[model samples]
Target: MAQSHRFWNWIARRYARMPIRDQASYREKLDRTQAVLQSDWDVLEFGCGTGTTALEHAPHVAEIRGIDSAPKMIEICRERAAAAGCANASFDLAAIDRLDQPDSSLDAVLGMSILHLVDDRDAVIANVFRMLRPGGAFISSTICLEGQARLFRQVILPIGNFLGVLPRIHAFSRTNLIAAFEAAGYEIEENWQPDEDPMKAVFVIARKPA
Candidate 1:
């Protein structure tokens, strides 16, 4: 995790400056996520790179807290929030697995493009489940490394990680991802893949039983 933190920190500036890969797809995700958010809800977005999505959702929720392991990422998030005047949004330098929130304390948790990056995704899912109130949602966008992208995870990424040139990436199929959420007791509310290509990220909205 520490090594991943360093890698992210090193790329934080470039990452913040980069534009969203797919604007239309990103908007669709934001719309779907907003539909699940209540005006008075409290949200937490883990691995919130530069806090773009968190800030976008801030106006719809009472407050949204963004957390990331990289200090530079968190710093950039704070700066973006301040510049945008998004008072309802805040950021912290922390990892989701290490976050100590009281059980059933939050209204929703967002894990956009983050689950596969973690060391123990199941544990993180379990922790998110425990943090949300009954009927709360866990929204996430993850790249499931299967089909065409399988080689990148199985071969290229391994060599890059070994050479200290790339961060670690976990490879799992889309079926495996859905099963993990269901296994953690979350009911699937939405499962979407914007592109037919296996390289596209899968967006999911899961709810805890009320």
Candidate 2:
């Protein structure tokens, strides 16, 4: 947890100066995300760093809540929400295991660059399933860790980041992930590559069956 805290502190700093590509990607993703929204949906965004996508999507919906494990990241999200005048959006700092929301409270849940950060992916999915109302969905974009990103995160990049370790978050194939989500009670709706190599993050939308 200490490592993650320090690691995300650096990430928050880096996000403060995101490149044009990063900013553009988030903007485009928000459009794609909004296209799938149900009118008046209650949305929950996981791993919402600095509320980038949360604030972007909040105005397009009735209610949005963003969660992150990093305290500083959630603080940045709060600050951004205030700056954007997004009263419908809120930010919380909580581990996946400690999420305190009521059962079946949300209409949909989103995980962007966030699932791989979890140590137990299936358990996280199960927790998400428990939080969503019937027929709700979980949208995610993930690092497969089978591609160049693995080499960079495991070998080339510093040894400090385990979020990319092959046997854990990055270990499963896309098929395996689908199966895992299914096991956790979601039916896969959409899955596709949205970027280039090493970082060819794939997006998925999985819904809880009614």
- Candidate 1 residue-wise lDDT, 85-161, digit = tens: 88999999999888889999999999999888899999999999999999999999999986656678788998888
| Top candidate by lDDT | 1
TM-score of each: 0.97, 0.86
Error of 2 at 209 (Å): 0.9
Candidate 2 residue pairs in backbone clash: none
Q: Which regions in candidate 2 have their CA more than 4 angstroms from the true location?
A: 20-28, 147-150, 162-169, 195-198
For 1-210, candidate 2 gives per-residue lDDT tens digits of 334666776668677568646665566666777887776999988878878778878877789989888788998999888988889999998776678889999888888877766777888899999999998888888777654456665665445455532222344566677788888778887877655544666678888899
**How much lDDT does each candidate structure score?**
0.92, 0.76
Error of 2 at 206 (Å): 0.4
Clashing pairs in 1: none
Provide the global lDDT of candidate 1 against the true structure: 0.92
